[model samples]
Target: MRMVQKPSSVVLASLKPSTYTNRTPRAGTLPAHRLAGVSKPDAPYSSRRAPRCGLVGRTFSPFTIVLLVILGGVVATAAQEDERATVEPTLARRAATLILARCAVCHTTDLIVQQRLPEDRWTATVEKMVHWGADLTKDEAAVLLQYLTARYHPGAPDHLPSIENELAMTEPLRGQTTATDGPLTGLAARGAGLYAHNCQACHGEGAVGGVGPKLARNTILKNDGVFWETVLHGRGPMPAWGSVLSHQDIADIHAWLATR
Candidate 1:
């Protein structure tokens, strides 16, 4: 084998550290200064720093962090309160509907609205009503009780007028027959259907009395004027039918009741 000759000093001098130091680094390779934990002396200077990410990279004072946490908690609490406010009104409306459908069958709304009682008394009253043929389910009764207690409690405001006060204020109409009154012979058949639809619910089948006074053999039937006044202008829990029924309709109902 022939011996290899050594490189010249000029060639070695030309291949100095400065030549490759300024060159761009290859892909997937670390620069000498970075790998050795050293910085380049002639590198471009910059005031801007590399962007950081995530909570770990962020810096906040203890007070600022606590304030942010408190604000978040407040927002969460307010959202919960708003949800409760919305739900409460929905429940109240449902309960009110139940009361109107079920309770108003026997008694008027004014009778119920005027009373102010405790929860226990309300419970007793509700039980009594259920016993007296109020068609209420267990859940419906419970919901109704909750509504009554909330709205008609002892501490609640007495805004509605008393039924006794209302009755006392109004004078009884005397001899108040309508112009449509006539012979009751031919009209009784038509009046039967009208009475069944309008008056039968409260007055009982054949005017024998249920919630209202028994119309069977009642002296008021003989007097056409008093009957007309009572029917047209409401009495106690009875609603005024003047707005609902025509004069002929009232006369027809009267004719049917007279036969009963």
Candidate 2:
């Protein structure tokens, strides 16, 4: 207790001034990296670890760059496919054929479809056609009215479902009526059915006219069998009705049309 111990230089640093004048070493000094806060490895160690850290700091990760490139290519291909897959929205040309031939003759399709009345109003319209000597069978009348009311009426979209939607509702109706139903004797009646399906567009109820010449004027009366054949086979923009309808169906239709 009586003898006092002298402090070592390492411990006596506190006795030195807090701020001292620069005393630069002549040969070399302790590492400047350590003074700035970095610590060098103790002994022999691989130097590659520091370089790897620098690479990560200096650039985008290679994996991230590759992912961005792949995503960009996928987005480009999707855009191209969308451009090529444009869809159309309108009544199919085939659907218009009958309406154009049969209904447009008396009044414009614009007028006909625009009327947009109830079921009773539609029945009255068909009945009026009957009063005018239009030869439509009961079934033909129903089909014609149904077709018109479905496509043209304001209430149609609600009451009458489209064929596509009907896949869940009812079996799709077929165009193939029994051939035995065909008869030259009943040709006029059969033709009425065909007319509702095919001729209503331009011919109207009695083959009047909107876009084409009227049948009531006997334009059809003067046509020869060959002429009929040519028209049926589509000489031009008229389209080949022969291909769309069966032979017996064609015969019955021809017979009914002749009566009209």
Q: Model 1 — TM-score against the truth?
A: 0.36
Tell me the spans in candidate 1 whose CA falls farther than 4 Å from its real position.
1-105, 111-186
The deviation in Å at residue 226 for candidate 2 is 4.2
Residue 117, model 2: lDDT of 54
The residue-by-residue lDDT of candidate 1 on 1-260, one tens digit each, is 11122212112222222221122222345444443444345424322322221134568643344444345445433433332232244345445555544676677667788776667788899999999978677777877776565555443343633433333233243434465545444377888987776777788999999888898789998897888788876677776555345677777777878887
Question: Between which residue pairs do clashes occur in model 1?
Answer: none
lDDT of 2 by residue, 1-260 (tens): 01122212112121111111112111234334533445456445546545432336657643343344345435433432332122111212223333434443454345554454545677798889867755555544555564454343332222333332322233234434332343434356766787666656655677765455566646554564653564455433344454345555556656666676
Instruction: Compare the candidates by TM-score and give the number of the best one.
Output: 1
